[model samples]
Target: MDPRVREHAEIIVDHSVDVGPDDEVLLRGHPVAEDLMIAIAELCGERGANLSVRSSSSRVDRAYRKAIDAEDISQSAVSLAGAEATDVAIAVRADANTFETSDIDPEKTSAMARVNKEIQEEIMGKRWVGTQYPAPANAQDAEMSTDAYESFVWGAINKNWAAVREHQAQMVEILDPAEEVRIRSGEETDITMSVAGNPTQNDFAERNLPGGEVFTAPVPDSVEGEVHFDKPLMAQGREVQGVRLRFENGEVVDHSAEKNETVLTAVLNTDPGASRLGELGIGMNRDIDQFTYNMLFDEKMGDTVHMALGRAYEDTVGEANERNDSSMHMDMIVDMSEDSTIEVDGEVVQRDGAFVFEDHFE
Candidate 1:
């Protein structure tokens, strides 16, 4: 019954997916986010949009995955059909337990992702947006109180998206026509990849609420060098930290992790494209100044860069460029707050997290 919850739902309906009259809107979220869902459903009703609600539960999913054999895991025809039929899909995340599926077999997780790739693609092809509802478990993971976490989530979500788009457009201009980009953080991370002919997407809370990144796909065979992602990320219900990857000819040749190495290995072995870079994104949302253990927000924090290891988005790749395809798209972040520079072509654009155009750039 918080005002921000209704505000969040309004953004999802009016700005994110833009549910119109007679549209089929599919809403999926945990029951904990029922208030927000109800707000969204009410808005959909007012707009004359048909609503299909799916209550997702991490516990239920964990039990199912634990009970099923890896080989027996298959895509649900109903799920695919629903995705195909929906005009707008809004997925809200509110985790009751961040590590609910940590005990599940990595191989089985990979298998499930592989089987559901089609469903994912079908949903992605629609007018869709994924946002998170501040939940107690997530707050604990972020090392923040519940009230503070709610404020953080809504502060990042309910904002001037147009201004964000305008601010991020500057980065898009630099990447859209660039031939190559180099990213470096201290001596541990240094990598270069070509972005020629790839379209840079300026994200501003449309597909991803709280979105404030400019992203593009790399040339499939043009990446070379090494990178150490100092930031930790949650993957497969486990925390993966200190990920270091060496790339040669756009494929990861060497990889290691300080934690959850097996999870990283499972992800890398998911498919052929899993070993290659799918996306190169620059975070420009200064409002999200802290790491919250949530990629939805962390990846958009200023002074950060994130790269996904699989499944390049269709819009980021040019028709002439090859799109990296995989069942997984895991984002890992690199801290650029100090001892870092993002070089476009040969010029330094961001030095120690300050873009050259920013007033603070030294």
Candidate 2:
């Protein structure tokens, strides 16, 4: 194992998760992330934490994708129940390839999705963290050296975390100020929303090195107009691009794409909540100026913003507008580098990805 991997392991073990003594820790990832996994286990043991590691792989998943029955796919990962019951659980994404071009049984995938949803509810909002472990595939598709990709991911996480914190504070100040912020993009983007009385919650700030974008749960049924996802999305191991969505009452009334429309439709139709906007986030990490085809990282890149069509996070501004139900959360990015703006309560706060507030972005 590389020494840096060990250093990263320490960060994951100590910083990302404050694993206390006797805490039941569930460490999970695919085989490609094993080095870090082993290091996490070692750290857990040293900390006197009870640790259980679950190593999943793309090859094994391919076997199921090739031969498994749709109805039984959910049952194969039954062991997940134990992990779900643990005190702290971490999912490290280390897939061999981000895009797996195979005839995947949609039904099987759906069943897996359902099971995962059940698991999320089982925890009923427990303390957990999700992160990534860079592999050759993610690096290859990113068109950058692995070292560069690692830095990109790191900077994205670090900067986004900071932005979220800063935005949360700014939101508090803006919420009480007397203003109905009016904002407009340069052209072709007329998106608007009212953040007059929204509560900005602190994202998982005490837990991880999470950074990139700060977000708020928009008022359900309050958004109007259309927006185009300027960047392609990496969905379920495949690249889905050119997504266009039309919203009415903050719900996705109509959507289409030049690519992967079928998959997008299937995901949207997965549940009723899938049709609604869950989160509206702006990427503000200048360090992450390029798209890497990973929503976990890309949505936090500066000059971009994303709208999640389903499942609002617990810590977002808005009322019971919690669109949380679907096992799915999709992040489609819109490049705001040109001809785009975001307003908070009628005041133009961000024009073409730059903050309007003083000392907000420096």
Candidate 3:
């Protein structure tokens, strides 16, 4: 096994989820990541943690979804039981075929998401982390060779998270007490939302392996204006590009996509909260300098900002703030490398992707 694979597993077990003595750990991944899983399991054993491994196959999932009627889709009892019993849950993504589920009906996908929302929330309530394995399919999706993709993944994952926390703390301080934020990019994107009493979270590879973002929930009815996500994202096995949304009173009043508009429509129509802004996040990890078709990596790249359209994490919401609830939380990114400014309460903090505190700010 490559030393980097062990290092990746160490970060997941020791740093991300912090598996400890007697902890009940639920590990889920595809067989393609067996090496990484073995390393993690070994580490868990050394730590005296009990491990339960679940293997997933995208092809099998596609088959099941294709065969099942939309109305018959329901939450899996075994999944719910595992989620409820686990003390720590670690999910790894290693796709053999990224497009295996592409033909599944969007409505069926949405229905499944709706039914599994409870299990998702349950898992979210535990110590959990999600990371990606550099499978060939994912490498191809990112338009990089497998070896290059492995280097990229480990470079982003095996790092000093303490320094990252300190660096992102600056943004957390800026957003935590601010009442409102305005984001603008080129002539196509301009948006505003209230953070108000919401708490800002400084992520440093704990909840998300390779995490390097500062995020917070927007007040349920406080978002207004329009945003054009120039970056393309893979959603429901399809590439969605040029997503433009207009928000009125925190709900998406208008939406469109240059590609896969139907997927976007299905997502927005998933639930009542699906059309509202849930999270506002800023990417701070300069290490992830390139775009990957994966949200796990792309949303953490520097010179970008992301927003999720549903289901705010409870931790990011203040006791007094209303949390946005939905079955889905889809993140879309905007390029802020040029002609962009992030204003906090009317004062510009970032201009053209450089924060005011950085040495290069002009």
Candidate 4:
């Protein structure tokens, strides 16, 4: 076993969730993450914490996807009760099959997400953290060798998290009071939204191991103009490419996708709030520079920007601040490494993927 795996577990249990004696924790993840789970369990046990582990297999998910219909896809009442009873929740992702559900029905997939809305709400309301392991399937998706991927993953995970947190504080300071934010990338991406009274949340590898982004929910009815997403995003068993959304009065009035247009359309039609912007995120994690086709890391990649459609975080300036609400939260990335600028309150904060004021981040 790699010593770093244990170290990673210790960091999560001790720092991420802050599991203490007599604390009740719900742990769930792929069976492939057993080693990391063991280390985490041992740490929790030594701290006298009670943990319930749900070791799941990717094949099980595949079976569920194939066997279930939209109406059949509801949250387990038992699981909901369990989550509500737990003090902390830690989930690990180490999938053996990244595209295990590629053949599943898109509507059914959306239904599954809709059904689990309450469960996600309860979990996110708790002290929770979700991280991923370096699985072979993940490496293949990132188009890198397993060894290279492992190095990339671990290097991003283990960092000067304190520095990262401090670095992100500057962004929060600027965004916390800003009313309007504008993003421009070349001529294809130019969108404006009002943050107003929303609270800005700065993450530094806490809930996510490779986390380094400052995000906030935008006022649902204040969006204007259009934007294009250039990154490859996988959604509901389908891959979407070249997504473009045009907004008016804060609702998506027009949208297109070069690939998987049907899936994207179905998602936008999921509910009333699905066509609105929920969260506006600015990526600042310089350590993670590669596209892994995984939103967990890609959404935090430096020199990139991501926005989520559907539900906004209830605690952080989303529904908490009267932002958009829905059962879904789909994040899509857009490149901002060059020919782009993010202006907060008409002040240029970042230009061409580099912060105009980089001192605070360093």
Candidate 5:
């Protein structure tokens, strides 16, 4: 019955997924987000829409962690039952990391992730939107004060939509030339790839409006050399830091990490397609500087770039490149603020954490 829950529900139903009167909507959230979930259902009813709510909590995931033995968790009857039943899906994170820092098997965590990925892939038209209902548990160790973290999260999530037309113009100017951009994090990082002839960066306005990222599927076999990720990455509930991946002919030939090497190995070994890169995106929201351990907003933080290891989005590029596979799309971040440069074709477009077009746009 909290007023904020109704406000947040309106944001999701009216903005994020934009549920229509005829749309069959599915709303999923942890117990902490029950208020918002109920608000969404009520909102759907008011809007003349058919809504189904699938409620879950951190305790459910914890149960799976201790009791589940399968590598694929999505195969469970409950998950399979919800796969294609709705036109849109909303996942609200509420204290998901309740036990993240505790003692848990890495293998079990990865297995749970694989299940979620399977559900996402099978329900391709679901038009998923992920966000968070902040909980104290998530901010326990954050470097920034809780107030500051909330500000950062709010600014990052609403950055694109709040400014709308202006944000679109800025994106066009940054990606205008449509050329290959050479990037380096240091001698250890030498990654060069082409973004030429790809779709011009456009707003998801009226569709996936909360989305701040303007991404493209990378050239399947164009990625070459090795690069070390500058930010710590969390996957399948396990944290991986100081990752260095060596690429040969666009496939991950070798990879090592200072933390969670076994989990990384498991991801790379998921399938042949898992070894190849799929997405190459640069974060543009200047308001988001620090990491919050959430990929939805983290991958869109300014002066940073992330690459997904599997499953390129079909709408991102041409159909000639058929490398998209794997149930996973693990996004890992790299900082471009220090001792790094991005050369578009032969022209340098960014250096030392600044963009050449910053003055021209925004």
Candidate 6:
């Protein structure tokens, strides 16, 4: 076993979920993450914590999606029961084949997603963290050598996460009190929305490891104008790039993508809430400088911001903020490294990939 696998497991157990004595820890991951899961189990044993693990495979997922009818695909009672009974839930995403389900019909896959949304939300309510374990397929998808990709994953994970959180909180401080936010990047991207009354979350490895983003829910029905997302977006096990969206009254009235336009169309048609904005997040993790085409890392890259379409997280939008609800929470990334400025009620907060008040980050 690679030493980093043990180190990664230790971080997840000690810091991320903080598994302690007599705790019921539910560890879920793909087969590629078995080593890390074993490491976590060993650590849990040492701490006198009980650990339950579920190892999955892409082949199994592919077979199940193909075998089951869309309507028949429903949430697992056993999974929900496990979530309810567990004190800590750590999910490892180790994709043996990143695009394994790219060929499946979007509607079929979306149906499964919808069915599992509530169970997922229940798991999210627990002390949980989602991290990735590097696999050969992920390296190939990222177009890097396995060793290089492993280095990248570890580098992003083994950071001073606490320091990153402290730095991100400063940006949250600025955003929490703001009434409105305007994002502009030349003529290609220009969008405005209200953040008033929504709580801001400073993410630093709480929900996601390698995390460094400050986010909040946009006021439902408050978005206006057009925006273009240049970064490649991963959703429904496929990649969509060069997205341009025009919003009116918070609804995605018109949208286009240079690649996978049909998939994009199907994504919007997933449900009513799929057409509205759910989250607005600013990436602040300077260490994650490159895009791996993985959302967990890409959305936290410096000089970038992402907007998600679908259900709002209760940490930002309260449970009562139920107007926006859907199985889809697709995040589309927008680069802010050049000719872009984020204004909070007419005052500049970030300009050209850097925060306006630079000292706060330093």
TM-score leader = 1
| Native-structure RMSD, model 3 | 2.4
Instruction: For each candidate in the order shown, give its overall lDDT on alpha carbons.
Output: 0.92, 0.68, 0.92, 0.87, 0.71, 0.87
The runs of at least 3 residues in candidate 4 whose Cα sits more than 4 Å from the true structure, single-residue gaps closed, are 61-78, 102-119, 318-321, 359-362
Clashes of 5: 0
Ranking by TM-score: 1, 3, 6, 4, 2, 5
Per-candidate alpha-carbon RMSD to the true structure: 2.3, 3.6, 2.4, 2.7, 4.0, 2.6
lDDT of 4 by residue, 109-178 (tens): 7777777789888998899999988888878988999899988888778777788889889889999889
State the lDDT at 121 in candidate 2: 60
Q: Candidate 6's residue-wise lDDT over 1-362, tens digit each?
A: 88888888888888888889979988888887778888988999999998898888878888888888887887888877887898889989888787787777878877877777777878877899999888899888788899999999888888777788788888999999888999999778999999888889998887799788999999879999899998998765668989999999999999999999988999899999999999999999887788888888999999999999988887787544444787678999999988999999898899888896685422
lDDT of 1: 0.92
Please give the range of 10 consecutive residues that has the lowest summed lDDT in model 6.
318-327
Q: How many clashes in each structure? A: 0, 12, 0, 0, 0, 0
Q: Which prediction has more favorable lDDT, 2 or 3?
A: 3
Off by over 4 Å in 1: 63-77, 105-116
Listed in order, each prediction's TM-score against the native is 0.91, 0.82, 0.90, 0.90, 0.80, 0.90
RMSD of 2: 3.6
- What are the clashing pairs of model 3? none
- Per-residue CA lDDT of model 1 for 1-362, tens digit only, reads 89998999998999888899979999999988888898999999999999999998999999999999887999999999999999999999888887888898978988898899999999988999999998898899889999999999999898888788888888888889999999999998999999999999999899999898999999988999999999999887778999999999999999999999999999899899999999999998888989988888999998999999999999999998899998679999999999999999999999999998889999
- The TM-score of candidate 6 is 0.90
Candidate 2, residues 1-362, lDDT tens digits: the string is 76666766666667667898979888878898888788788899999999888887777777767786665555434665684668888778878876562567666766676767767665445656777777787788788898888776655554334346665566445543322323344443456554444554434334434454556666666767777786898775667888877778767788888888888888889788788777777665577778776666687677777788788776564453443455567888888777666666555666666676746433
What lDDT tens digits, residue by residue, belong to model 5 across residues 214-258?
677667777888889978888766899999998877888889999
Better of 3 and 5 by lDDT: 3
lDDT of 2: 0.68
lDDT of 3 by residue, 1-362 (tens): 99999999999999899899979999999988888999999999999999999988999989999999887999999899989999999999998987888888878987998899999999999999999889898899889999999999999999989888998888898999999999999998999999999999999999888899999999979999999999998776778999999999998999999999999998899899999988999999888999988888999999999999999999899998899998679999999999999999999999998998889999
